[model samples]
Target: MTTARRKPYGVKGAPYAFLLPATVLFSSFFALPIGYAVWLSFHKVHVFGLGLGKGARSEVWAGVENYTDALTDSELLDGALRVLGYGCIVVPVMLGLALLFALMLDAEKVRLAPFTRLAIFLPYAVPGVVAALLWGFLYLPDVSPFSFVLEKLGLPQPDLLDGGPLYLALSNIAVWGGTGFNMIVIYTSLRAVPAEVYEAAKLDGATPLQIALRIKIPMVASSLVLTFFFSIIATLQVFNEPTTLKPLTNSVSTTWSPLMKVYRDAFGTGDIHQAAAEAVIIALATLVLSFGFLRAANRRDKQEAAG
Candidate 1:
């Protein structure tokens, strides 16, 4: 047998060289900040008598004090509950609409498929802040066309900015912005499915709805899981949409979400240590929930395959 030929000089280092920039950027932007935040999370500042002077405030080890306070804070807990409620509305509605639209797009002889898809997807191109601002204007009784029409029809114009309506209003914004992107994801997955499978189903007397429910949906389960995973993460980190809406309504408090509470602690109250702890907690929760979901999905997939 002939000896294996040696690779060219520096060949072993080529992949590392190519990855060097990305690695450096990741460490600089993501890893370093996370590490620093974790370090800050376990520490607190001690103020000297004057609360003003050189070394007046010094960092000191606080163990889990910051975390304990964060856990006990009613504001943080309330924010988390609000987010959970919002997510309960958002994730299901958004993903359902997305799946529905994708199915409709895939159906035969659908009218205006291209235009409809484009119209549904156009909102994705708009920045979240701008979208919230636009929607915010539309929510105003004085400015909204819906309100204008309600006035013309002599119907009551309810406030969309407060109370139970506020949750729906916020959820609608998220659903509208998210559905199109998710539709694209599911539709792309649907298109990748082998045409032969559908043809075989058709030959076996499967109707469009039957095929969609039985065959198409199953094939795109992976896409659904992916969208769900992302939707959860997005729901948990909801900030910009609600933040943008803040100027338009008084109902949206500064601590509308856990992430928002963290922001309030960090910049609003000048409590970096507490903020860091809250941030770390949110990050950990996100990771735990995300991995737990992924594992469940994987286990289900394995079970199906085994069957």
Candidate 2:
């Protein structure tokens, strides 16, 4: 104790000093907005007689009334159902294509691997709104080359922007834009697997498909899970594609997605309190579903390990 030396003040405070900017930025941008939203969720406007004067309206505490209304709202529920249906198509198809492309890229004797990977991934760099707009044009019967070809061939040209096909159209845009990123993630994971493992598999007379199924896939299971997790969250929060396509299609309503509904409630109807409440609900639902999936995945992993 007598021989102990004191640390310099700068060294002792260095970690906090380094973190100060991030802490300030997080508090200012993220934390403050979230706190304000939560605060707004629990408050509503109270209007006096005629609702005309400057002092006529005031903010008042609203308990759980906003949350109750949001839960009971048919529009919100329908939007949730629509998003769920969209997710069902998007998640599996996107992940499947990603895995397929990643495996193909990782295979031996593959030609132009870098070019192929870049071609597949380039769509992801495009903004979602631009992607939607581009696809929206393709979906239009008059402007679409597919429709023109079908007409020339004397075949039926299906309406892609309306009814059942609308879901497929939206799902395609998501899959196209998302597959590349997931493929890269999975491919990176694959590249990290030991070469000796592949050599041993080859020595055991395993074919390429067998090796991929047994060794490669199992080794990349965590990557798959991670992609799946992100896919689920993105699916639930879908807004841009639908919103961008909305102008071109009569089928996409103002309340097409939960987020769209939130936007409509906040700006369209000028009800920030209601919008905040709905936003909070959507955030809570996303959190619950994400964590629930993670928990199930963890439990399965633990069981597999024990087995």
Q: Report the CA-based lDDT of candidate 2 relative to the real structure.
A: 0.97
* Residue-level lDDT tens digits of model 2 in 243-284: 999999899999999999999999999999999999999999
Best by lDDT: 2
For candidate 1, the C-alpha RMSD (Å) to the true structure equals 2.2
State the lDDT at 147 in candidate 2.
97
Write one digit per residue (lDDT tens) for candidate 1, span 32-64: 999999999999999999889898989999999
lDDT for each of the candidates?
A: 0.95, 0.97
Off by over 4 Å in 2: 1-9
Name the best candidate (by TM-score).
2
Q: Name the weakest run of 10 consecutive residues (lDDT summed) in model 2.
A: 1-10
Deviation in Å, model 1, residue 140 alpha carbon: 0.9
